[model samples]
Target: MTETTIPKRGVPLWVQIIIWVFIAALLVLVGITLNKRQQGTVQPGDKIPDFTLPLFSGYEYEGKSEVKLSDFQGKVVVLNFWASWCKPCEQEAAELEEAWQFYKPGGQVIFLGADYVDTEPEARAYLKKFGITFANGPDMGTKISQMFRIRGVPETYFIDQTGELYYVKVGPFVSVNEIKSIVDQKLK
Candidate 1:
């Protein structure tokens, strides 16, 4: 004669404990990954989706106010995403500033910066430290980062007046010449 043992109704105590432990571990890992992704890690050829996140004031000399992607339409825009803590971003800030200076005269291309995942005070401080005179904004809640799916700091999007992304630079620009070359290629 053969007999079958039935499984426990509320799950085996040992098995339940193991499952709970695993679930807890998994939740913890997921939470960490999500926090990391909030800062984003972008890639090339990613389409620039339209987003209207808040741009904090005081970074620019005049018209120092909030700006959205839609705000600067009808002009070639260099939308650079960066943070205060990124070394490469700090390195490229001046080059981007120079590009802004060069392009501002012709009104050919407008350059704007976004202080991703940072405080207004920190962002403004970075601007002062890096000598980035272009207008900037704070991604207070990281709305813009999520919207564009930014992979990391120092991602520059060459967007035409229609808000279409033409080129994406993942790292810093070395010189105004380099910035100009890319801008010239796309602004037209």
Candidate 2:
């Protein structure tokens, strides 16, 4: 008597699909990690991948009409992540203005601000009050905040001419005048 090999059929189709789905998800996440920003702690030596996003810099801030990180290539960029609700950010705005005015002309350095999560109306008002004339705008929840790994308001990252993250300010950046030295050294 010849015995035929019978296929085992105890597992349901749904179970197989679920297992496949989980595996697929895991693979996708691994791919994203390898392609996007790496998970390692970012330091001055790490180079940031080029990214483009719409910024709402004031209607008049030089280079504000429409700004992108790529546009500032080959220059020192002071990138400040701020919000309308942060008091420390409000305090730092004036100094940001001073620094922007001083550094913008002569084309030596560039200042850029990204509004972390705020309403458009409030953002517009902040623009007028803060005197932020450099590249300023809102991230609009389009994955920008996640890309930056923002834990709180007022995280500033300085990028050098080579598009490498030079410095990262954890809290509200105070004493804008003090930054002049830092900016001059890196921006020059």
Candidate 3:
């Protein structure tokens, strides 16, 4: 009888490479997520992050598409992040518009609507429905949202004239007075 040797089977080289590549990609993704989480959201007393917003059609300032946070210096800035599909946003839509109208003449307060992740037609329609006349615009690439670390739609930030965040409202303001109170305090 002759002695026989058996061959051992192992994972293919290409298969092992693919597995390693997959694991590496997954690790990279997790690292990015952790980094973002560590950055955290903007908070009261923090200096407002400077950002430029591209206003929607018919909402531009001085016929300019780009509006910078610094442009509204020496004025209180009400930066509201909202979406057309958000119910809580809808609830405060009219109130926000009213507040804008009230403060429009003074020019001491500037209201900027940052429509979050919304389509133009629908966002325009939502604005028309609510009669929003503020400097409403799309948060392009969600850069503003990321900079502010917004949790959801209808989050409003009150920035004082000095470019410091004074307050953060996580949800809809129940009344125009509620919105005004914050603005009044910041304007002081």
Whole-model alpha-carbon lDDT for candidate 2:
0.75
Best by lDDT: 3
User: Candidate 2 on 1-188: residue-level lDDT in tens?
Assistant: 99999998788999999999999999999999886655533566678776655667344345446666777788888877888888878877888789888876668688777888788788778878876677777776645657667677787778888888878777765787767867877743
Clashing pairs in 2: 56-137, 57-136
lDDT of 1 by residue, 1-188 (tens): 99999976887789999999999999999999888677554444454666654546556525636666677778878879998888899788888887788888787677778788776677788888877777787766788767777778898878877777777788888888988888787655
TM values, all candidates: 0.71, 0.75, 0.81
Q: lDDT score, residue 87, model 2?
A: 81
Model 1, C-alpha of 162: deviation from truth (Å): 1.7
Best candidate according to TM-score = 3
Q: How many backbone clashes does candidate 1 have?
A: 3
lDDT of each: 0.77, 0.75, 0.92
List the lowest-lDDT window of 10 residues for candidate 2.
57-66
Candidate 3 local lDDT, 1-188, one digit each (tens):
99988978989999999999999999999999998888767889999878999999898877888799999899999999999999999999999999999999998999999999999999999999988888989999999999999889889999999899999999999999999989999665
The local distance difference test score of model 3 is: 0.92
Q: How are the candidates ranked when ordered by lDDT, highest leading? A: 3, 1, 2
